[model samples]
Target chain A: MVVAVAEESRGADHARPWIDQAKSDYWQLIDTEHRLEDLYNLVNVPQAIWIDEKGTIVRPPETAGSTDHFRRMDLKTRTLLPKDQEERLAARQAYVDAVRAWVTSGKHALSANAVRANLPRITPEMAESRARFRLGVWLRANGRAAEGDRQMAEASRLYPDSWSMWRQAADLDEVGKASSPAFWKRVQALGDKPYYPPPKF
Target chain B: MTKILTPTAEHDVAARDGLWMSPADAERVTGWTLKPEGMCRAEACVPLPASAVGTNEVDLAAFWARLGGPVIASDERDVWALGAPADERNATLEGLAAPDFTLPDVNGVPRSLSQLRGKKVFLATWASW
Candidate 1:
């Protein structure tokens, strides 16, 4: 029997097609359950945990399978360029391969700390940037548009090229009454990187 | 050192629920922030719009509803409050032993986690919206 955990955020609607494809291809797809606000708890996508017959977590949290809808050209060698894109792509590919290995070999085949040890180190700046991002989201959600914008601006300064940051800033601007076309344009100007589409309202 | 509140704390407070949280609460306890990403104590991060930085409160309703999260509400001081369980379908706490829960499937038949015991359960989540 197989149980699957689907961590859904606002934009998860866009992932449905790809998830369906994964179910058809790799997994038996027995049960699909949704976890709300799970991303904030689970941190990474495609996280998988294996439970033994006694309901003990046999395998700790690990990055599981992923859906890659984009082609090589879509991610690599894309139009608006960033030098880090290549590195990011390579890391993703490697991570995917590692997950595939885990699925095929099971827990015994791989060391438990293998995945955890390989995770990228979190820098103080990155942590601060993430905090500011959350603050911005919280502010906008609570109807504090200007405060949210300020937090978003700080995020951009810290992680200038992050698609996640830009997308968020755009969301705040679009939702609040203070939203402006110019703000949307600024978000668009951040240039196309491989960004997960926002969930439809 | 200044007290730091987990993302979840800010969220709970912003939601107007009196889910009390102390500033010294560890990230793991709150399950609100992760090492690299913004997750709660359970190490889950919902990809919401925002940089995951400074005082940004995510729209919990939007994020949870999209993810099919089970909305659990409580009333404190005459205000209706809402919170997303660690497990949406099962409504279990994170990092703890899985709780015994039974729910009807699309066919309206009841199923429980205990029934699936002994087999390695690979729970995968999905949604329509």
Candidate 2:
């Protein structure tokens, strides 16, 4: 079974059209509070976690076949050049093949110890940042925009790695700010660091 | 009244300076009720430290901090958020058990991760942005 979740603050208001377009028979959830982020330590989107029949996590959250090749795209054209697009597709296909192997033969599933070691570590700052993010979201929805923005900024400072938090806060301020030049600047700032670390089996 | 935020609910409760709230308010904000022994929810009980329990109120921030959860507040102290305990939040890392969550689908029907326990699940998350 496949369960897809749209982690949007506006919930169905923002995701309904995409959900409708998918036409998926599987469960499609709308998360307004980012429950998965708080629970699974997810930092970005297009991530997947594999669970087995006993509810054990066979795989911790990882990039679900997505790559950072978009960083090389032409922003003005908003398109990835053919070569980069092909490489991205190949990576996605490889991830899908691995998933198929796991489902069919449980060949790639990680042992419990391996899963434990691979789980993302929740640092003190990260935990506090998540709390501030939640508080900021609530404050913004409850008529405290300036205060909310402050809390969100503090959250971003505390956990610089959480592009999800920063982007969502940007989206709240301006509808297109998330994909704006600022996003590119942040990606460029990564320098040698990875935006989407490769998934480990 | 200060607005208290929890994972599943929010409440406006009376507080006297900082985050010290009446036991009743604490119980309302968090499902755990204050009793003679300690704070309790369902069958679990956690003994509160002396610093966390005041004359007739509880220092909610101290209580949650004792449980290794982050406690955040607004500048004016009008709003506060009590996060999940670090132990509970990171339990999946140690036990390999996927944490269960219930969320509303696009059609507004509530669905739970546990409902798919009998099968292999490819739990994928994406965003509209």
List TM-score (chain A only) for every prediction: 0.42, 0.96
Clashing pairs in 2: none
For the second chain, the TM-scores of the candidates in order are: 0.30, 0.80
Least accurate stretch of 10 residues (summed lDDT) in model 1 chain B? Answer: B72-81
True contacts kept of each: 0.30, 0.79
Candidate 1 wrong stretches, greater than 4 Å:
A1-109, A160-163, A175-201, B1-5, B11-129
Worst 10 residues of 2 chain B by lDDT: B85-94
Report the lDDT tens digits of candidate 2 across residue range B6-73.
87668888797878988988887777898878888888888998878988899878778877888998
Model 2 - which docking category? medium
lDDT of 2 by residue, A51-87 (tens): 9999999998999999989989988888999999999
lDDT of 1 by residue, B1-129 (tens): 112233243332323222223323323234444333434445466554453222434344343333443322211121112333323412232333444544434333456667887665654443322
For model 2, the TM-score of its B chain against the native B chain is 0.80
Question: Which structure among the candidates has the greatest DockQ?
Answer: 2
**Residue A133 CA error for candidate 2 (Å)?**
0.6
lDDT digits (tens) for residues A1-201 of candidate 1: 554433322233444565656655323221222221122223333455555556655444444443223222232434323544565466567654643544566533323344334323433344445555555554555566686677667755766544335444654455432224453454446466322321111
